[model samples]
Target: MEKLLGEFSIGLFFWQTVLFLALLFLLRKFAWKPILNAVNDREEGIKNALDSAEQAKREMENLQADNQKLLKEARAEREEMLKEAREIKNKMIDDAKEEAREEAGKLIAQAQASIQTEKKAAIAELKSQVANLSIEIAEKVVREELSNKDKQVKLVESMLGEATLN
Candidate 1:
């Protein structure tokens, strides 16, 4: 132990401390500034990259919202067009039905008018036939009675006696 203590001399310790101080000073002046500058540059690059990524994310979200709004507007316009088409179709159907009903009414009225005219014509024809038949019957009866002149004179005398002047 005494030998080991003896080896730790003041001169050796002072030289070692001097060398360490010189090395520390040299490293701080020549190496430390460039290394620290490199580290700071790398840190700045990483910060810029992170900021750009955040900006890109915000832009993508805005674009998605715009697309959704456009889709909703398109759907509403399509639905409105469909509703208008349905209204037009219903109106056309109603107009067609009304036209058909009017045509049918006109046809029925024409048929009734024709039937009334034919009935009047038939009644007129029947009356004419009946008048002709009565005239023929009266002529036959007068010819048979007048064939006998004596009987005709006796019939005329009886009619004259029953006749009134007024």
Candidate 2:
């Protein structure tokens, strides 16, 4: 070991050490700076991408909430519309029923009035026929009782004169 160390010069070791240190310094100044800057830029880009992804996730959640709210409002509106339609339908049905009842009552009243008129007409005709039949029967009975022609002629003349005076 001592022989090997003695063969090499102290000046040669010093020159080699200085050359290695200068190469290291030059690499750090030029190559290492650019490489480090590129690495740092890549890291910043990754962080920005992560932040954008997180923002997109939050936006999606907000959109989902808005969609849910819109869906609920649509359902509520549909329910309200259905309720209103049912009410209107019921009202229309009731109105139609009432109209039918009114028409039926009118028809019944007309039938009753017609029946009453016919009954009154029949009664009047029956009374007139009865009166005429009573008159005929009285004439037949008087004719049957008066057998004498001269007495019947005198009775008829007096009845006619009394009727004319009245």
Candidate 3:
């Protein structure tokens, strides 16, 4: 039993040593370099992804700032346009008022001129009527006063001469 145990112990020790050496060689040849390269590649990939994220974040911030600037400029332009519109509206109103005043003055002047012409025509008609009435009154008075035929003829001749002199 001792011999059997001793031989088994020796065989197990030799096999364990051989297996250890073979495992060391396999790790060096196949496992160690690939694992280290995989770790390095993973780290480089993480770093590149972080850099790309930072760049995108900066670009987004710049875009946000540009948008704000554009918004402000648009508001300013709107304000300026509104101010110009108001000024133009005021000027138009003033011009319209001036035109209305001028038209009113012209209308008043025309009305006054029309009134003056009517007044002159009315006065001329009245003067003509008065002159005709005066001539009629004079003829009736003279016909009543001069009844004798010869005296009537002489008085009419003398009155005609006096009228011509006057």
Who wins the lDDT comparison?
2
- Ranked candidates, highest lDDT first: 2, 3, 1
Per-candidate TM equals 0.60, 0.66, 0.59
Give the Cα error of residue 41 in candidate 3, in Å: 1.8
Using TM-score, rank the candidates from best to worst: 2, 1, 3
Candidate 3: worst-modelled 10 consecutive residues by lDDT:
138-147
lDDT of 3 by residue, 1-166 (tens): 9988767876778999999999988997899889999999999999999999999999999999999999999999999999999999999999999999999999999999999999899999898888788778867876776676887888788888988985
**Candidate 1 local lDDT, residue 153:** 82
Best by TM-score: 2
Taken over the whole model, the C-alpha lDDT of each candidate is 0.87, 0.93, 0.91
Q: Candidate 1, residue 87: CA error in Å? A: 1.2
Give residue 100's error in model 3 in angstroms.
1.7
Please provide, for model 2 over 30-80, each residue's C-alpha lDDT reduced to its tens digit, 9 standing for 90 to 100: 899999999999999999999999999999999999999999999999999
TM-score of 3: 0.59
Q: Root-mean-square deviation of each candidate, in angstroms?
A: 7.7, 7.8, 8.9
Clashing pairs in 1: none
